[model samples]
Target chain A: MPYLPTAQSFLEQSRLLISARPTTTRITTKYTLPKTSPPDPSKSKSPPPPSSEPSQPHQPQPPKATLTLKTYDPISGTCLKYETDKAAEVGRLIAALGSCGRVMAALPAKEEAVDEGAMEVDAPVKEDAEGKAKAVPKEKELKGGQGQGQHKGGEKGGGGGGGGKKKKGKK
Target chain B: MATGHLSTDEFLIRLATLFESRRSVNHGSVFLTQKRLSPHDLPKAATDTPLPPSSPFPDLHPPHPLPILIRATNGKSKDKRKDKIKLSTVIQADELEGFFMRYADVCKAGMSGLKKRDRSGRKAKGKAKKKKGASGGGVEGEKKG
Candidate 1:
């Protein structure tokens, strides 16, 4: 049973108690934190700033060459370039020479020719006994040479004989 | 049950009926038919049951000659036989020797290619070390003096 103050007296006593404590001023200043303002809601709607610089463009690399088959045809003396796909064709040509034995014999001769200052460019042209370069005759040239003097004479004689007989018959 | 004794006549009639039923039931099955053979009706003189004459138990035949047997009997060693005989030996020694030499060359080429790759790798490493030394010249200079 201590004295209970009236509401008006309680208010006056609270004011007196608060003012009388000088230590409370430092405590209030220390504990009373500054209010944290709400995060700026306006920032959310704005787009992020673009990167300062552009990226580098990509450069394309060139394709590389791969080596395949190497062949030397003695007849042509040509160092022909046969890719991987043409290997079968090369095999077929080799087989067509009856046996590999003949091809082996011819290859050394061509190699020797190449060694003797023959240009290693196109197919090696075979040289005659006189050491002169021999040319490869075309198919038409071969046929013409084969038919030569005899064929033309025979045709002329046959035609002339037939015409003479026709003229005689008409007369 | 009463004492059941059939008279001889009744017994004979029952036996006949039993046989008749047995015959009717065994129509298609010969294995089921009962054979009637009296002891008195057996064959008179017992025929000689010929003992199956054994085959002249295959007169100890000589062993068949084999290729290996011929080779053995001929007294030639395997290596000598292989060297001595010339069966359709299509391939010549010169050609085969040449092929073997070429194959050895090819193997050498492959080994050389690998060695070249290793040497090139070492060269690259050496170049990289040289480049690093050149690039770190300032550090080397700082350490030296």
Candidate 2:
């Protein structure tokens, strides 16, 4: 009876061992070996790291598009095509014409060149010349300088002589 | 009338606004003359917008209210200051409106494309990182147990 029990237990243990051995082998064969293998060098390599240097600052670039306009051709009596890269230039031109008109109006037409030249001269000189012109009448009353006195003398001669003639006729 | 004193920034702003208005009215190209506005009057003539009184650069011309010709392709000089005076570069009103509209549309399209590209790139990167993490965790768990 003892021998029989020992034989039965041994057979059961052998069966269990056989089953367990396969499962352990299967797990090891499937997972362990594949993982342990060296990673392919090509797969492991990554692209080069991004450059660490600071990037250049971006600047506001000019617009690439061009704008064109049609202007009157005085000689041809037809419109001619003109182009400008900027929009502001046109506005400025209009404004300039307006100012030119004002300049043309304020000064005598014959002295336009002289006035333009004077405007270009030093500001102090222009102020001084204006001041001298302003003082001309006042200086005439006190000192009677040639340019100022001549005008005053002519006025007095015309008025005073007329009054003397009237007084003589009354006497 | 005093445009000569107009600052470049003021001139530009005016030029932009002018272009916008002209565009609305179906005006053709805008032409800029060689004569520049006085820098002083540019701020007022260009726009109705008021600037901050306390600004440090108050002396500078306020932004322009109208669009201006900034560049001319056929002009002899590329320098803005020098080229502006040349008649060859002045663009007609109708041409300017067309150019601005086209430019704005192109810019809008480019911006949208960039946004879409950025979103797609982020999604792809996130998926790759998640896959890598899952694989790493599975390996670690098996080794520990």
Clashing pairs in 1: A76-A123, A76-A124, A77-A123, A77-A124, A78-A123, A78-A124
Model 1 chain A: weakest 10-residue lDDT segment is A25-34
Candidate 2: where are CA atoms >4 Å away?
Answer: A1-171, B1-103, B109-120
Candidate 1 structure quality by residue, lDDT tens digits, B6-101? 442343344334324323432110010001111122244522343233544211111211000000011124776552311111122124323323
Q: What is the lDDT of residue A105 in candidate 1?
A: 19
DockQ scores of all models, one per candidate: 0.00, 0.01
Please provide, for model 2 over A55-154, each residue's C-alpha lDDT reduced to its tens digit, 9 standing for 90 to 100. Answer: 4322232222333333222323333233333333333222222222222112211212332333322222322322334654354234424545676789
Q: Give model 2's docking category.
A: incorrect
lDDT of each: 0.27, 0.33
Query: How high is the lDDT of residue B145 in model 1?
Result: 78
